[model samples]
Target chain A: MTTFVDIQDVTHVYARAEDGAPAVQNLNLTVREDEFAAIVGPSGCGKSTLMKLATGLQFPREGTVIVGGREVGAPVKLAGMAFQNPTMLPWRTTLDNILLPLEIVEPHRSRLRKHKAEYVAKAECLLAQVGLKGQGHKFPWQLSGGMQQRASLCRALIHEPKLLMLDEPFGALDTFTREELWCVMRDLHAAQKVTIILVTHDLREAAFLADRIFCMSARPGRIVAEREVEFPRPRDLEITYSAPFASLVQELRGHIAQARAAA
Target chain B: MTTKRHLHLAPWIFTLGFFLAWEIICRVLKVSTFVLPAPSTIAQAIWEYRNQLAFHAMHTLWMTLAGFGIAVAFGLLLGMALGASRLINAGTYPLLVGFNSIPKVAVVPILVFWFGVGWVPPVMTAFLISFFPIVVNVATGIATVEPEMEDVLRALGASKRDIVFKVGVPRAMPYFFGSLKVAITLAYVGSVIGEQNASNVGIGNLLTRASAAFEVPLVWAALVVLAVLGVVMYVITALIERSMTGWAQRSDMAAA
Candidate 1:
C-alpha cells in the first residue's frame, strides 16, 4: 500500500509559560492510502497532538509532516475534521452548517455562488445520508446530541476530503448511539475508500473500527506498539461480541497499560 | 398566548399603579407643591403646556437619534478595527477607558466653544458617551469567536475576513443589541446634558428655564416627559433585539 501520510521523528512542545506540557516527542508513524487506523493512548499522552500534526494544525518542532506528496506548513486543506464537540454555529441551520466548508474551500468556493442550487442539493443529500431527512431547518441546540454529532460527521465529509480525521467524534454519545454511529462510519469507509485516522481512548472502539491500531506512550508521547487487526471489511457490531474481538481489545488494553505504567 | 399578553402588560400595570400610589401619598400627606407637586398638578401642567412640551420633546428626540446614529457608525467601525488586531486593542482600549471616564457634561463646554452651542454639541456628546459600549461589545464579540470554530474554519481554508463576517459578527449581534439598550439611554443623557449646559433648545433647556422661574409644576412636567421618552426609546430597542437576535436569548430570557 502507498503511504498517504508519513510523520517522521516529530517532537512538539505546547506553550511553555501556560501549559508547559511537552505534548509529543520523537513520534514516527505512517498511514497507508487504504488504511483505517486508530491512535489510542492514555489521557494527555498527545494523541490529539499527533492528529493535529498530521492535519498541519500544529507543526512539529523538530520533524517533518508529509501528506500526499507535500510538506505541511499550514492547515492541510485536503483533510476533513470532526471533533468531540459539534461546535455548530448557533445562528446557522443544519443545512447551512453542513454547507459551510464549500463556502470556504476553493474550486467549490469559486463555483458556489454560480451553482448555489446544486450545492444546496448536495448538502441536503449529505443530511439525508446521515438520516437527518427534512430536518435541515432545525438549529443545533434544537437537535439531540446524537443528531448533532451525526450532522457534524456529515459536515466533515461534505467537502469529499481524501483524509478524514475524527478526534473522538462519538466519545460523548451513549453506548447504543455510539455503536450505531460506528456502523455508519463503517459503511462510509467501505463506500468512500478514504483514509481515516480516528483518535480515541476506547480500546473496544480501536479494536473494532481500525484496520491497524498504533498504541502511543505517555507524554512526551511516542509510539510503543502497532497491532494489525485481521477483521474483514463491512464488519458489523456483532463482531464486537465475538471472542476474537474481546482478545483484540485486551491486547490493545495491555499495550496501553504498559504505556501508562512506563510514563 | 393570553399569558404572553399578560406578561407584556404586567409592566404597564405596575407603572400606572406606581403613579396612582404616588398621587395618593402626596394628597394624604398634604405635601407642598413647591417641594413635591402632586401627580394631578403635574398632569395638569403637562396638558396646559402640551404645545410647548411637545416642541421641546421633539427637538430632544431628533437630536438623540442623530447623535446615536453617529455613535453607532463610529463605534461599529472602531470596534471592528480593534477586534481585528491585538496591537490596536492594546493601544486603544486604555485610551478609550480614559475617555469614557471623563464626564460628557464637562466636554459640553469645550464642544460649545468649537461648534457654537447648537445641535452639534448635543449630537457629539451623545456620540461620545454612547460610543464605548458598542466598541467594547463588538470588540469582545470578535475577540471571543470560539477557538474550535476557528480551527474548523481554518482547516477548511476560510479566510480571516470570511470568518469575521460569517461567524464573529453574527456571534456579536446579541452583545451589540444588549449594548444598544444601554447606549440609547446614554445617548439621551448626553443630549440632555448638552442642552442643559449649552444649547438654547430641547427639554433640558425647558426644564432649566422652568426651574429658574419657580414654575415647579412645569419642571415636573418636563421631567415626566423625559422619563417617558427614555422608556419609549428603550422599548424600541428591546423590540429590535427580539426581532434581530431572538435566537441568542435563552428560553428564560424569551419568557422574561
Candidate 2:
C-alpha cells in the first residue's frame, strides 16, 4: 500500500511548553494507506502532539507533516477526530450530532440543506453499524458512556472521512465495553478501509487493533521502536489470551518503562 | 402522588404562610402602619388604589421591558465579542466590573442630567444595571466550550465562524436565559430607582408620592406589586429557558 501520511523529523513546541521542553522532538512516523496504526508511549510522551501535527491542528516548529501527499498547513479536511471525551453537543440529538461534520466540510456543506434526507439516512446507517440503531432521536446525555462513544465513532465516520484520528476513544469506557468497542473498531476497519491513527496508552489495545504499533519515548517524544502484528485479519478477543499477545504486550511495556526511566 | 402534589403546592403554601405570620405579628404588636403595614391593610390599599396602581405598574413594566430588551441585544453582541476573543474579554472585563460596581442609583442622577426627568433615565438605568449579568454569563458560556469539542469541528477545517455558531452560541443559550432571569429582576430595581428620583410615572414614583403623603399602606402595596412583577418576569424567563435548553437541564430539574 502507498504511504498516505508521512512525518519527517518533526519537532513541535507548544506555546506554553512546560519546563522549556518541546512537546515532541524529532518525531518521525508514517502510516500507509488504509492501514490501522497505533502509537503507544509513556505518560506526557507527546503522542497527542503528534496527532495534532498529523491532523494539522497544530504546526510543527521544525520539519514536515504530509497527509495524502500534500504538506499540511491547516487542519486536514479529510480527517475526522475523536478524543477521550465524546464531546457531543448536548443540544443536538445523536443523529444531528453525527451529521455535524457534514455541515462544516464541503461538498457536503454546500449540498447538506438540499440533500438532508439522504444525509440523515446515511447517518442512521452509520448509527446502526455502530450498534446504536434507532437511538438517533435521543439527546447524547440520554445515552450511557459506551453508547455515547459508539455515537461518537459513528460521527467520526459519517462524512466518509479518508483519515480517522482516535485519541484514546475507549479510555473512558469500562473493560467489557472497551473490548466490545475494539471488536466494533476491527469490523469498521475491515468494512470501511479507512486509514486510522490511534493514540493510546493501552498496550493490549494497540496489539489487538493496530497492524503496526509505534512506541515512543517519554518527554519530548520520538518513536523508539515499531513492531508489526503478523496476526491475520478478523482479530478476535480470544487471541488476547494467547502467549504471543502477552509477549508482544510485555515487549511494548518494556520499551515504555525504559523510556520512562531515561526521562 | 401526594408528595408530588405537595411539591407543586409548596411555593404557594410558603408564600401565604409568610404573609399570615407577618399579619399576626403586626396585629399582636399593634404596630403602626407607617412602621410596617399588615398584609391585609396592603391588600385593602391595593383594592382602594387599584386604578392608579395599575397605571403606574404598567408604566414601570413598559420601562423595564424596554430597557431589558436593549440590554439583551447589546449584551449578546458585546458578550459574543468578549467571548470570541480572550484579549478582548480580559481588557474589557475589569472595566465592566468597575462600571457595574458603581451603584446604578448614582447613575440615575447623571442620566437625569443628560435625558431629564422622564422615561429615558429609568430606561437607561435598567439597561446599565441589567446588561452586566448577561455579558458575564454569555461570555462564560462561550468560553467554556471544551477544547475537544472545538477540535472535532476544527479538525474538519471548519472556520472560526462555524465553530462559534455551531458550538459557542448554542452552548451559551442556557447561560443567556439564566442571566435574563437575573437581569430582569435587576432591571426592575434600576427602573424603580430611576423613577423614585427622576421619572413622573411608574410604581417607583407612586411609591415616593405615597410615602411622602404618609400613605404607608399604599407604599407597601406598591412594593407588593413590584415583587409580584419581578416573580412573574422570572417565571416567564424560566419558561423560555426550559423550552430553549431542555437538553441542558438534568432530568429532575426538567421534570420540576
Q: Give the alpha carbon lDDT tens digit for every residue of A20-45 in model 1.
A: 66689889999999589999999989
What are the DockQ scores of the candidates, in order?
0.77, 0.89
Q: How many residue pairs clash in each candidate?
A: 0, 0
Clashing residue pairs in candidate 2 (N, C-alpha, C atoms within 3 angstroms): none
Please write out the lDDT profile of model 2 over residues B1-256, one tens digit for every residue.
9989999999999999999999999999999988998999999999999999999999999999999999999999999888889999999999999999999988988897899999999999999999999999889998888999888899899988898889999999999999999999999999999899998999999999998999889999999999999999999999899888988887775676
Docking class of 2: high
Pairs that collide, model 1 = none
Interface RMSD of each: 1.1, 0.7
lDDT of 2 by residue, A194-255 (tens): 99999999999999999999999998899999999988988889999999999999999999
Q: Estimate the lDDT of model 1.
A: 0.89
Candidate 2 accuracy as lDDT? 0.93
**Per-model lDDT:** 0.89, 0.93
Which stretches of candidate 1 lie above 4 Å from their native place? A16-21, B1-6
